[model samples]
Target chain A: MTRAFNFSAGPAALPAEVLQQAAEEMLDWHGAGMGVMEMSHRGREFMSILAQAQADLRELLAVPDNYRILFMQGGALAENAIIPMNLLGQRPDERRTADYVVTGAWSVKSQKEARRYCDVNIAASTEADKFTRLPAQAEWRLSKDPAYVHVCTNETIHGVEYFWTPDLAAAGLPDVPLVADVSSHILSRPLDVSRFGVIYGGAQKNIGPSGLTLVIVRDDLLDRSLPVCPTAFHWKTVAENDSMYNTPPTYAIYIAGLVFQWLKRRGGLAAMEAQNKAKAELLYGYLDNSGFYRTAVAKDCRSRMNVPFFLHDETLNDVFLAGARERGLLQLKGHKSVGGMRASIYNAMPLEGVTALVDYLREFERSHG
Target chain B: MTRAFNFSAGPAALPAEVLQQAAEEMLDWHGAGMGVMEMSHRGREFMSILAQAQADLRELLAVPDNYRILFMQGGALAENAIIPMNLLGQRPDERRTADYVVTGAWSVKSQKEARRYCDVNIAASTEADKFTRLPAQAEWRLSKDPAYVHVCTNETIHGVEYFWTPDLAAAGLPDVPLVADVSSHILSRPLDVSRFGVIYGGAQKNIGPSGLTLVIVRDDLLDRSLPVCPTAFHWKTVAENDSMYNTPPTYAIYIAGLVFQWLKRRGGLAAMEAQNKAKAELLYGYLDNSGFYRTAVAKDCRSRMNVPFFLHDETLNDVFLAGARERGLLQLKGHKSVGGMRASIYNAMPLEGVTALVDYLREFERSHG
Candidate 1:
C-alpha cells in the first residue's frame, strides 16, 4: 500500500521523505557502523546528530539567542506538572498564583495538573460560550502578582487556536511571562519567540515522534525550579547539560532532525506557514460555504491545523468515514468527545490532501443530504 | 562499512537482525500506510504494537502476576527522582526514610536524587574502597523500617553487579521491598522476578533503544504517589491505563518488542545467561592470564556484563584504543571517570565479538610490549 495522508491530531503525519531517510540509515548511520538508536548519547556520532538538530531547530524557528531548546522525554501531558514545578519557584514560597486561561480542553488539563503544585487563578475562561471562540484579551482578570500565565496556544481536541501571542505586559502582569502548550500547531506558522517565556509541545504532532518533547524556554526562566522538581525535568539542569543530563531519545531526535532538515529544504517555517494556511482555508472555506457541513468553532478561532466539522445529518458519519478510508483519506473521524469529522492537515500534509478531503466532503453530502 | 562491535556502556549494541527487520518495516508497518512514528497513539495500529511489546517482554522476563509492566519515557536517570516521588507518599508525611546502597557512580546518583523528595538513609557505601568492591550485606546498616531499599544491581560505570538478590530477612530488614536498577544487564541474564518490588532500567543497554524505560513493579506499589508527582509518572495511573496515562514512546517500544522476540527465539533468558557468561569468561580469562592486563574488582563480585580491564603499562592506553578501533571495535574506551578500557558484552554481543575483542587486546599488547 502507498503512503496515505494521515489526519491524526497527534503522532500525526510526518513527511514521507523523512521516513525514507530514517529507513536508509536504520542499520549503519553515515558509515558510523551503528544505527542512531545504538549510538551512545555520549559518543561522538550521536553528539553530532544532537548538535545539528539543536542548531537546525534554532535556525528554522529563528529562535531568540536567549532561548534554550531542550530535547526531552515525556509529552506535554507530563509537562503540565513540570511547568508549575519549574516556574512557581520564581514566586519563592509557591504562595503567589499562576494564572490560567481555559480556552479549551488542553488548557483545562494544564491548570488542573498545576493546582497540585500551587494556587491556580483562573484569569479568564470562554467555557460560558462553549469554547467556540478564543476569549478576547480585554476580558482577562489576572491575579495580583502571579508567578506565570499558562495557555494552550492551540487545542488538539477542541480545535481552537490563539494565532497571536497575548501581550502580557499590557495585560497588567508586566513581569509575568506566558507559557504556551503549542503541541498541535508549532511549526505551522511564524511565532514571535520573544513574546512567550516558554513554548513546549510533544513531538508526536508537528514535530517528529511521541517520545521526544521540545521545550523552548527563556534563559531567565532557568534555575528557578521548586526543590521537589525531578532532576530529569529540572530545566536548569537539562539546559546546562544541553539536554544530555540523561540518555536522550536518540532515534526520535534523529528522525526529528531529519524533519527539521526537510523543513529547511522547503524554505523553512515561512513557506510551511503559507502551505498550512492554504490547506486549512481550502477545507474551512468549503465548510463555511457548504450547507450540509458546518464547523463548530467561530471563524476567528478555528484551528488552521485541526478543523472539526459536523455533518448536518450525523447518522451518515460512518458512511462518510468508510468512503474516506476507502479513498485513502485516513483518520478523518473526529474525536469521540466531539463526534463528527476532523481533518488535521498539519505541516506535512500537502495542499492536494486537503483538496481531496474537500472533494470527498461535497461528494458525501451529495449522496446523503 | 559493515556493523562494528559496539562496546558502548549504553545505547549499546543491538542484534543486527533486529536492526535489519526495523529497517524493513520503517516505511509501512504491516501494510499500514503511515510509519509507526506518524500513527495516532490511540489508533489500533499503535495499540497492537504496544500490547505485543508488553506481552513479549513479560514472557521473556517471566514477570510475576503480581507485577505490572509500565512502558515510560525518561531513562533510569529520571527514575532516580521518580522512584522517590512515587514511593515517598507511602510514608504519608515524607518523614520515613528510603535506604540506599551506594556501590558506584550510578547508585551515588540515585541516592542524591532521592534526597530532593525524601529522607535518604545510606545503608552502606564502597567509596572508601574506591568502588573496587561491593559492600557486603553484613556491613549494611539497615534503617529502622525504611520505605524501600534501592540498589543498582548492575552498575554500568564501575563494572560491578549483584549476581543474586540480597535477602532482606537474613539481613534483618525483613519484609522490606527492594528496587533494582538493572540498566546495564537486564536481559543479559535470567532473574528471579519475585525477589524484588521493582525492576526498572533504561532500554539503551541490552533491551532496545534510548527512549523507553521498562518498569516492572509490584501491583501493590501503585497509587502511592506524592501529591506533586506528575500524573504521567504516577505508577497507578500508568498501570491502570496500560502505560497510556501519557503517550508512550511508540517507536522505541516497537523496536524493543522486536528485541524481545529475538531474545525469546534464542531460548529466553537462560540461554542468554549461558551465552553472556561464556563471552564474559572468554574476555576475563584472557585478562586474568595476561601479564600486560589486569582487572580491578574482586573475582567473586566481578560483573559478567561489563568487563573493565586495565593495561599494566598505562602509557600504552591510547595505542591500545587506536589499534582496537582500527580492527572495528568501537566505543571500547572506559568511562572518563575511570580511564582504561571496558568491554560490555551484553545480550546482543555474540561470543565471537568478545573473541575478536580479546584477539585485538593481544595484538595491541604484542606491538606495545
Candidate 2:
C-alpha cells in the first residue's frame, strides 16, 4: 500500500489502514451482498455499523451518560449556525444572547453565524494580537446568564489552542456551560467530555471523512432549541432518534467508525495523544531552532496538531512547496488568508512523516541560506 | 468487477462503472496523491468534481439557466423541514402558512414537518384511500397566497407517482410555486425543470450515495428564506457559494458525478427512462396476469420507480422472500409501514436484473401454487 503523506487541512490525511478496509469492503460488506454505501440506513447491516461507531466513540472519549452523541452532516462551518440554533437563545427570542471568545478564524465565524439566531456578546477577542494567543479568561466580559459561551479550542489557520475549557466559576457564573469547536484537534488528545456542555468537530480532521460532523452534547442542551430551529438541526430530536432523524451520512459514519476502531487498536486515545505530541514536538523543535523558519503563535498555546510556519525568504515558497510535493509530502501550502506553509500533522500523520519534514526543513535551510 | 443486483429503496444500488472507478481512484485521484475523500472541497481537484457534477445534472435534467443547483446534505427527510424554513413564512415573523397536497406516506411527512415552522393548509389528501392513488388536481383546495405548495411527486413507500407537475391554476392559485420531493423517481424518467420552483432528492436512489442531497431551485426562490432558517439550509447562501457553504459530502458528490457521466455514456435520461419503463412493465406485466400476486395502487398512478406487490397467500411471503434471496435478487422487502413486498428498480438496475426478478417471480408462484 504505497501512499504519500497528505497534509491538506480539513479533508486531510486518513489512516492508511482505514482506507484499505473501506476499499476491501466497497462491493460487499461482510457478505451482506451490498456495500455499506448501497445498504439501507434502516437495514440491520448499517444499523450495526452506526451503533458500533457511537459506542466506540463514547468509550474512546469517556463520554458521560448524559451526553448524547450525534452524527450530523454540514461540517464545522455549518455547525457555526447549527450550534446556535440548537443550544442558544434560551430566553424569550430577542432577549437571549450567546457569549463568544474569539481566538482565530473559526471562532470569529462561530460568533458571526450565531448573530443570525440571537444576540451575540463578544466576551473576549484576540484579533488585536493577530490571533497568536487566546484571550485570558479574566479579561472576558460575559453577559449575565448568557445562553452559552463559545470557544474554538484549536484555531486551524492561526495554530493556537486552548489547553483547558473555560472555568466560569471564577467569574461567578458556574452554571454557564462551555461550547467548543474542537474541529482541528478533538481526538488528537484525551478530552474531558463532562467538562463542556457541547463538544463538536468536523470528521475531516482527526476523525474521518468531511461530510460527517460529530456532536457530543449534554442531554439538557437538546431541549433548549429556539422555535425557529430547523427540525433536522434540532439536537433534542437528533439525540432522541440517535442521529437517524435524517440519513446521517452513512458512508462517512462508517469511515469514522473505522477510524475509531483504528484508534482503539493503537491503544486508544492515550497512545494517539502521545504520538501526536511527539510528532508535533519534532516539527516545532526544528522550527524553533532554525534561523530560516519561524512560527507566530504564543509558545504556551501553540497548537500541537496544526503547526503553521513561515519561511524567512518568502520568495522561495513555491520552490519549497514543489520540492515537498516531489518528495511525496503533499498539500503543505498554508491557507490563502495566512500564506506560507502549514504542516497539519493530524492523527493520521505518523512520526516518520514529521521526521521526513524535519529533515527536509534542515536541508532546505542549509542550501538556501 | 462481479456484483449482485441491489434493489434497496434508498442508499440503493449504484452503477457498476461508478463503483469500479471510485475504487480505482480511492488512493490517488488522477495523481493528486490523495483520494477524493481527503481532498479539500475548495481545492482544484474537488472543485472540478463539484462543478462537473452540477453541470452534468443541469444537462441531464435540461435545467434552465436561472436554476441554481445546490449540492447539500441532510437527505430528503431534512428537506421536509428545510423546505418550509426556506420557502414558507416569506412574510416576516409570527410564521407564515404553506399549502400541502398529501398523497401518501412521504407527503404526510412533508406536511407534518412543515407544521413546526409554518401554518399548513391541507390542499388535498388521498390518505383516506389508503394512499392508493393521487387525488384529482381539480379537487385540490389550495390556500390563498400560500408561501408555496408542497407535493411528493413520487411516494417511495406507497408506490404512487405524479407523472405531471401540479398545475396551480387548476387550484385557482396560478401564482403559487410548486415544491416537489422527487427523491425516489428523479432520474428514472425525463423531467422538465421549469415546471417546479424546486426539485430535491437524496442521492442514494439515482444520484450516488446517502449523504448528498441535490436541490434544483429557481433563482428567484433563493431570497424567500425565513429569518429562522439555518444559514446552511438558506438557498440564497447555498446558491451563492455553489454549495460550498458547508464542506459538502465530497466523496458522495464525486461518486454521483461518476454516475452522471455513466448516464451520459449510456445516452442520458431519455435512454434511462425507456429502460426503467421496460423494467417496471416486466414486473408489473407479470403481476397483472399471475393472479397469485397483486398490486393495489391505481394503474394510472403506479410509480415506475418503486413497484410494490403482494402475494395472494400471506403465508407464502416468507418463502417468496427466501427464494428471491437465494437467487441473489435481494432487498425486495417493502417498507415496514406497508405489508407487501417492494422492488425498486432505479436507473442502476439493468433490464437483465428485472428479467431475473420476473423469472424468479414466475418460478416462485408455480412452486407455491
TM-score of each: 0.98, 0.97
Clashing pairs in 2: none
Residue ranges of candidate 2 with Cα displaced over 4 Å: A88-90, B88-95, B169-174
Which one wins on TM-score? Answer: 1
Binned by DockQ into CAPRI classes (incorrect, acceptable, medium, high), candidate 1 is high
Candidate 2 residue lDDT tens string, B1-369: 246777889889887777778877888889887889998788889999999988898899999999999988888888888888788645854438889999988889889988888889999999889999898888888777788899999999999998877887777777778999999999877899888999898888988888889999998888887776777888999988989877788999999999999999999999999998889989899999998999999999999989989998988888888888888888889888988799999999999999999999889888887
Give me the displacement of residue A270 in model 1, in angstroms: 0.8
How do the residues A1-369 of candidate 2 rate in per-residue lDDT, one tens digit apiece?
Answer: 247888888788898889888988888889887788998888889999999999999999999999999998888887888887787546777667889999888898889989888889999998999899887888899999788889999999889988877887778878878899999998888999888999898899899888899999998888887766767788988988889987778999999999999999999999998998899888999999988999999988999888899999999999999888888888889988788999999999999988999988888898897
- Clash number for each model: 1, 0
- Model 1, span A1-369: residue lDDT tens: 788778988888889889888989988999998888888889889999999999999999899999999988899999999998898776666465799999888898899999989999999998887778998889889888888999998988889988767999898777788999999999887888899999999998888988999999999998778888999999999999999999999999998999999999999999998898889888888999999998889888899999988998898889898899888888888988788988898988999899888888888878887
lDDT of each: 0.89, 0.87
